[model samples]
Target: MDVTIQELKQREAEGKNDYVLLDVREDYERAEFNVGGIHIPLGVLTASFDKLANHKDDEIIVYCRSGKRSGMAQHLLQQSGFTNVRNLEGGMLAYQG
Candidate 1:
């Protein structure tokens, strides 16, 4: 599953923090800029699944450098029993625009 940048922005405008936005990028990538997401690098997501366990089955939006990693993460989360996982389409590059 995926969400457009506009949809995400509208959700933000609605003050909807109900969804968890997970950033699978590296720490350095996050330091440069992010969509106010939790800093969980892709390399650590699986091992640190406990940290995100609470968000499972919730509205979780995963993203990465170019959407590839996040897509993988989304798949992993789904396999791990996360019900409402979505990938941010086009990633931050699209969001920045």
Candidate 2:
């Protein structure tokens, strides 16, 4: 599933903290800008997935420059048995826009 920027912003505005933000962008990209979260680049995600075992059932929101990479990450997390992985629709582009 996917979450829109407006939904995320509304949650932030309401102070309803109930999800995890997983930024899948590269280090440089994150350095440029980030909404903040667990910093794990998608390139090393396969090797680092074990780091997220404790969050298998938690709501994890994945994002990148565009929605494509995060969509892939969402599929990967779902395949790996993560129960609530969601991709940020339109990714940072929509968020910044």
Candidate 3:
């Protein structure tokens, strides 16, 4: 499911730290700006699965520059048994809006 930046902000305000916010963009992209997420570039998601093992069943909010990479990552997570995964509606661009 797609979540708006406003909704994500709300969740953060609520101290919803139970979820894992996965930023699937590249390192340079993250260096520019990010919504305080765990950076794990899309190309390395499968290899970095161990980094997110703790959040297998936990809520995961994935995002990228335009939601493309993150959306794909979300599906991959689901396929790997991630029960709760959400893709930022429009990624950083949407959030910036």
RMSD of each: 0.9, 0.7, 1.1
Number of the top lDDT candidate: 2
> In model 1, what lDDT does residue 24 have?
95
Instruction: Give stretches of model 2 more than 4 Å off.
Output: none
Candidate no. 2 TM-score: 0.96
Estimate the TM-score of every prediction. Answer: 0.95, 0.96, 0.93
lDDT of each: 0.89, 0.91, 0.90
lDDT of 1 by residue, 1-97 (tens): 6988899999899998889999999988998889877778888888989999888778999988788999999998999999999999989888997
Q: Is candidate 2 or 3 superior in lDDT?
A: 2
Model 3 clash pairs are none
**For candidate 1, what is the lDDT?**
0.89
Q: Write the per-residue lDDT of candidate 2 for residues 7-96, one digit (tens) a residue.
A: 999999999889999999999999998999998888889789988988999999999999899998899889899999999999998899
Evaluate residue 80 in candidate 2 and report its C-alpha lDDT on the 0 to 100 scale: 90
Query: Candidate 2's C-alpha lDDT?
Result: 0.91
Between candidates 1 and 3, the lDDT winner: 3
